[model samples]
Target: MCVLKLKPAYKDYLWGGHRLVDRYNKEYDGEILAESWELSCHPDGKSVIAEGPWAGKTLEEYIRAEGKGILGENCRRFRDFPVLIKFIDAKQDLSIQVHPDNRYALKHEGQYGKTEMWYVVEAGPGAFLYYGFQREISREEFAQRIRDDTLTEVLHKVPVQKGDMLFIEAGTIHAIGKDILIAEIQQNSNVTYRVYDYGRVGKDGKKRDLHIEKALAVTNRVPLVRAKNSYPHVADCDYFTVDKLNLDGKMMDRMEGCVSEESFVSILVLDGEGTVACGKDGEQRVTYRKGDSLFLTAGSGRYVVEGRCDALVTTIRSQSAPVRIGIDIGGTNTKIGLVDVHHRLIDTVSIPTKTERDPEDVIADVGKAVQELLDLNHIPLDACMGAGVGMPGTVDRENGCVRYSNNIPWENVPLAEELGKILPVPVAVANDADCAALGEAVAGAGKDVSDMVMVTLGTGVGGGVILDGKIFSGRLTGGCELGHMAIYEGGELCTCGRRGCLEAYASATALIRDAKRAALADPDSLLWELCGGEIGKLDPEMVFAAAEQKDPAGMKLTDDYVRHLGTGIVNIVNLFRPEAVLLGGGISAQGTVLTDRLNSCLKAECFGGEHGQIPEVRTAKLGNLAGMIGAAALLVMEG
Candidate 1:
């Protein structure tokens, strides 16, 4: 339902020619037409919606109005629109330049770095462009050559022709030569460091500026190896995948494909004319000719391009690739998993958590474990979208710090910042309980429901609340403490010095405590035999097992435990009224036995009982891996 035709913004630079305006039919009166920002959301030049109800608005505004989901699941990983497409016509050679990578750009330029690919639309005979160095050169020699204006002498020049594709990665010294028309697809960044400008003068009659120092720091001073990309698809990378579409009026007059929910489709018309039909019924049709650009929202169903044309179709592929690292930092161990956009756990690794060591040492070990996991799985650090850490206790998710962690001996620890220093990707930190809830909501049992609550009946009854498919951490990232809610006033003392907290009576530890006391009182009970007559060895599992055998004492303990837990569940249902109440942790392994009893309790005691549909009580499907998976989901949700 969301289809957009974009109008490009024109750019006129001193080295530009009028080919784009004269040949491509770009509307411009400038003496030189440098580039046409055909599809862009960058602040420097945003393309406007050429037609539709949202006409006259910028592409960014349209995306904001429609919600980013229309961009598709793949774009979910990016905080901003990932790609920028432009048509460039060089009348004169551009300055020798290099672009910094994300790490360097973010630090020095406060923006993303550029990694571009150019598809030569047309090139004059004997025309060539710089790619990299012709041979390996020392840093000193490179700098000397730049200073002496002999940098081009050592640069590798590749002759271009119609339909030639050149992929220019970040940190590669390159320049666009004269008499060449190029279609460039690149990251949504404008940071370029120029090394040599050939003493060209701008309109002001002053020599253009040079960023030699910064360029030298980032550029690769070595021979540029030419490699051929796959056919049909000229270039593919983390940011965008581009495919060439050449249809003559005979053999291939029409191209058809379903734009899946995974990524949006972008078509840039290079030549000829066509009618693009899209939507569920394919009723919406638009006439596109040379220089026309069209955007189809993700999950648009089916589309068809008919007529003779040479175009480039670019789509995002974030889902099919492994892009995120999920880390669950428990008290005893740290678990890491490589997760793809589809929520599949490709591989996982575990490392012991030496909580007794210094925080710095622990972080270093965690970083090392991550590196080992990547190396073992044959994944490059750059390929990882980002890293998410789920740690026990209160965490400042906004600041990526552990406000306080009783289990890990950490207080106000900058966990994300520390780990980011050692890892190539960005780092995010959150409460383990929150991560579990988010994980369930995204890829586990709660995937079918948008609103739900996860109550982890573990050592301390940790839990998280999810609202509208996002973790509800409340104000200051501390509100979702489901275990601390009071259930019985002035009763058992809680670990927080509070009376009758849910954790005091409903947690696994609480259940075990009660079971031990009961066994001590009734020595003939099955609980005693299950624990080998040793009261200290009694656990919640033994008590549940005894109840399953219809033992009186075990029945009583089970009933009381269920009643207390059900009371807590009832309170949550009455308060949030979520679509589902997911039970997690060790106790949840009991499955149906636990869920059936809890459902009964909810029917008997919850508000509005016996009327309307209550939340579905289910066990967490992800189990112990929930926290790690949820941590990875944070990158997508937050972005």
Candidate 2:
């Protein structure tokens, strides 16, 4: 059964009383029962399974055994368990303390910061707790009050009653009052900065240490205005969503819901005696009562609770879904997107590459774009799996370096290492063409196919090979330079210092060069009029447009271009024989007009002509967004 009833770990502190043992049925022989770590998986204190096949095992152990998928999709976004639930019994006034925010706590304490909510389970009459400052105070005055042992003078002490809920955000100076039994749900961290301890001494008769300087540095010195959030749940945050569940023995005996694969469910029973049933058939059951904690793994299917109970049900929400940041670096522009596990582009932004600057400067600009995209989507850095970047070059994927990029002036740049310093998550770098192929394979035109290749005929004939759904970059990550293959050896001087490479004839740049030569030679043709009699003003679109009109120069250039492109396609088909040959980039915008002619040429000249079906040549569906999306998919593929 996925549902687990837990045995809490107990803590004995000086300010604690035995109320938890007497009232909540907590089993502890210690003189002072301060807190019961009910649903914790923290290294310091983890709850054990009480009655099940997994009995005697810690929650952490059970999770490791069952696999993380049980934690559901939303909870998986967190690196560790997202929450800690506990019962706090304060016989005497607890220490006045505050917690640092994640930024400070993670830096100083190596853990998440605490943002807790207290539900007054049992509060004695005349009981009050310190919440925050009564009014705004200067830093000097706050320090003076702390030094004079009069910090409580400025504190807002709110009287508490049973069932009242108070949220204590990190950095809010607060203390639990005497004679209070509270159920606290907070971040999975144990960093506390004590402001005052009532001059209390420990068992050794020494005064407990104070964190006055740290508290002063982190505490909010302003008055905290009380506000309540309205949602279907009791409280919702990026970390967790909490809902209240109340069942009466007579009328409401059962409650049920499905725990989706996105997040695990946590049940903290405040007051209850019931059997929780979980599983597809609802046969798996575990008995629970007051002070009992239960954990239900994500995707546990259906769960039902029977008998009377007052409890808090916590689940990770969709907004906390794990995502990856994908960046596609072009010569002129860089595009970034926040892509969820499903390959959906939730949010995107584009920034100028500014490649004239140093590679580090360009990477810093990309990092800023990444941060802005995260902020726009309200996604925490921890929620992202990592960042993936695709640039035009021979990328050393293992070292995360760009070996060389002919279009962008980068050579042997450690792209990932430099970007990682600026971003919070891990960074991965690959060739931009390889990323587009991956994008098309996972989410675009070739998504359904197993083996496919993407050929982007933009500035150059850039393409990538996918074999059995994985990138087929050969040894040293250098083999998939499809454009450099010599289609006409010793014929035309190519950019790679080779003669008559595929890129020299089939690329948009190559087509433009051919068009310029043709325009100069054919002065009486439409190519001259289209370029306004200047050979430098020629473009691929003008050549194709004139060809559609059957202009002599246009038709001749189009036929030669298609023949060269078709020969390159036939070579790829005879080699790997992918399921689909996807065409992308600026030229692909011409759509079927380009594809149809290229298909005809392939059918006429391919090696296996008239014997077998040729690979379907289609325009890429993701167009300009393909590179970024593909880069994002690399995280999922590699992970």
Candidate 3:
């Protein structure tokens, strides 16, 4: 009931060729195949369910039978299905066109606006497309240029190749150039305002109609200059969020992910083939190749992709607009964030954590700070679902007690009970590492995985384990003590009075400590030069920087560090066998440098090696805010 395979509604536009029919295996009788509405619910052309008992049913019919609830809470905001996915083949130039915004479209056309993104599948040599105007032009000039047949002269032509992605907002004049094929994800509406046709005639021997006035009214006169930001999403806007995935078959051939209750998932594969399954046992599995569209209902929970392919995953990140509060307690400062149902961190505030003060006084200060945070965002105290706190040490989640926290240097603090007394809403407390791991599982690097282990290599090697979409905090003492696990038998003294623990060898503090020793030992080495010949000035980055420079001392330090960390991680893999091992904290910023080495190390040292499912090593996406957002989620998540 969760997974659905679709058969597209094909279109034979005048400018199209048989590329889709010939190369893409589109079952079409026409000579030209311009577009295939791969996963549509539009009345103009609906995609039919292509398999099982639903074989002959249109997607709309299937939705009507299943009820709209299957679309997830987020889709309830829209009047109909929010998105339409298709594959477009432009054998010749498509007409320069524009689409109206929602307001205009709803008012004049009674449909949603068109805001689309194009993922180039194939581009022949010298292929180019008109994006927008090169420079801002007046309405009079625009009209005159079209009348004079000089419109293309003013348009911004972009030379395109395979793999390029372009986001086209409504009202941006654009045209697909000849010999280009692409996958398009857009609003469900098909309201188009063809503005220019290059004097082409149809079967009736008449030029295509152009909505000049409507196009003028909606068209953005100013040149569109797309500004790229640092957000991880491919195309994140109010309507939809898109993410690209690739399984190269060697390094990655399988992807395991979870579909939360907030949004349904639409995966449109652009290249390669593989099995797409829902649930752990593959009950709703489909063996599909390229040009396939797979839909997973909301809360499908566990979905797997096993194949060599590049696909774009589209989902609605926002839910029904419920917001929750999250608090992350660190040694120096605490971060507070608002998490909406989309599992995204909406807003964040920070305050210094004066641990030297009385615990009750500090708790009172946190309450005051929470009120200030709500007031600043113009949110009422009762507006939030609840508040969740992530503490630095072992947290008794059920009893809301801080049993023992070496970082906060506190024991037996009733955090949840006290915070609840003031907040007037449900409050949940959890270990800081657990919160980070949960956040990653819910929305970050481990968002798609059911089983995940997050290791935070910070001041101490902190870790959390996620099993089947929930935190695995074993006992009241806060289990999954990943860092305390011994790496070397009685080799090094750990801060927790343990001998040869991972925390003593794998943490950033440990790295810096070793760097300082190496600097003192080798006064003439690059480690000393990077740390300015001062042993006390040595930091973790200085060690990695020296290693990046290929210094012998730095190489030795990094090699030993990775070896020690790798041994501990290998043990984690052999034990948990999670889909991914997410690395967080300041040290994870090293990106591929650290993960690449660890993956290689895991390959060599893991018990089964390549014969088993090797967990991919990736950097945690949410970064420092993971704890805060994940803490907020605890108020809504199942234990």
Best by lDDT: 1
What digit string (tens of lDDT, one per residue) describes model 3 on residues 446-495? 87678999999988899899988789978546578999999889978999
Report lDDT (Cα) of residue 110, candidate 2: 90
State the displacement of the C-alpha of residue 462, model 3, in Å, after optimal TM-score superposition. Answer: 0.6
On the 0 to 100 scale, the lDDT of residue 121 in model 3 is 91
Q: Tell me which of candidates 1 and 3 scores higher on lDDT.
A: 1
Task: Return the lDDT, model 1, position 386.
Answer: 92
Error of 1 at 404 (Å): 0.9
lDDT of candidates 1 onward, in order: 0.89, 0.87, 0.87
Which 10-residue window in model 3 sums to the lowest lDDT?
Answer: 222-231
Q: Cα deviation of 112 in candidate 3 (Å)?
A: 8.7
Q: Cα RMSD (Å) per model?
A: 20.9, 19.0, 14.5
Model 3's lDDT to the true fold?
0.87
What candidate 3 gets wrong by more than 4 Å, as runs, is 1-321
Per-residue error for 293 in candidate 2, Å, reads 19
Model 1 spans with C-alpha error above 4 angstroms? 1-321
lDDT of 1 by residue, 1-639 (tens): 556889998888899999998889788998999999999999999999998778899999988988998899989878788999999999999888999977698799887888899999989999999998888899999989988999889888889999989988888899999999999999989998988888889999998888888988998785644353445578887788999888996899998889999999999999989799998788888889999999999989889999998999999886433579999999999999999765779899999998999989999999999999989988889888899999998898889999899888999899999999999688888899999999998888898787899999888888999998888988776658899999999989999899999999988889989998888788789998899988898888898999999888999999999899999999999999999999998888889999999998888887887785688899999998898899998887743
Clashing pairs in 1: 323-385
